[model samples]
Target: MVGCPLTWQRVSINETIAPEDVAFIIPGKTTLAEIVARLGAPDEITSPDGRITYTPFGLRMITRTPQVITASYPGAVARYRFLDFKRFRANFTWGLKFIQPVPGIPDDFVFESGGIGTDEFLVVLDSNWIVRQHAFAKHADASRYRPWPFDLEPPDDNQVVSF
Candidate 1:
């Protein structure tokens, strides 16, 4: 059998998104069309049980009709389970390193891989959509975290925290 030589090249992938670029996407006010316009078409769109989901940078925006009803940003907890210490350690170390330069980054924030892949995010919906809920499988890939515009602020000490 003839042998083939293998070569590899190091490629740098730069994502141009700044936190401010997506800051304008308000949970209740931002429409699906606005999202498509600003972020450019999503990588995927899924409609299940009348709810539409758009995944961009692994960020999920669920909607019904053409308006955005809910937006879910990725978080570390979903990506790092208690049992999966390797991922948990990687995510935690990343978080620590991230906070030093970006002091405003929240403790709950996570670094998620962008582009097309099945990753999850912490889903927080408007009060109106409180009834809708999805359960994660025991072995489901935990939510991958992405930095959102709003999460850039240091949480208020007096604000009641809920996850």
Candidate 2:
């Protein structure tokens, strides 16, 4: 009951993938090289045969995943990274927050809290290096800036656009 919340907003990193981008990828028609040209290099590529078996995750490297990408045959997983902090802030909770301004505080202080999110688009390729499967497990969507620290309504932050 002292400081008033000043700002509320979403933050993001990198560029997000669009549905139109996915449209260009055909399971049999889309080749690995074509995807590379359209979406750039993948953040992590997992080979079922273990040619390049290592995959890095965060500060520490993890071997079992990426953007939730995996397949049964010789293929590749392409990950597109996008930054959206506003969406990131909504996904995780920071516990209860002060909705009202402090009665004793002289100046209004904004919650000024938020973080960036990693929006990913993963494309799984087949043995022929053609797109076998893909999805935007994390589709970046609508967001807003609020004065309250906590969202009165659930934020449309974590969307799993599976296809």
Please report the candidate that would top lDDT against the real structure: 2
The list of candidate 1 runs beyond 4 A from truth reads 1-16, 48-163
In candidate 2, what are the lDDT values of residues 36-139, reduced to their tens digit? 88777776667645444433222225554564534555565666666565511231222224343445643333354344444677777777788878878663
Error of 1 at 76 (Å): 22
TM-score of each: 0.26, 0.55
Model 1's alpha-carbon lDDT is 0.35
Question: With candidate 2 superimposed using the best TM-score fit, by how many Å does residue 49's alpha carbon deviate from the native?
Answer: 9.8
Instruction: List the lowest-lDDT window of 10 residues for candidate 1.
Output: 76-85
* Poorest 10 consecutive residues by lDDT, candidate 2: 87-96
Q: Model 1 over residues 49-78: C-alpha lDDT tens digits?
A: 224433443443454556554544321111
Residue 60 accuracy (lDDT) in model 2 = 28
List all candidate RMSDs to the true structure: 18.6, 9.6
Q: What TM-score does prediction 2 earn?
A: 0.55
Q: Model 2 segments beyond 4 Å from truth?
A: 1-11, 48-73, 87-108, 113-116, 139-144, 151-163
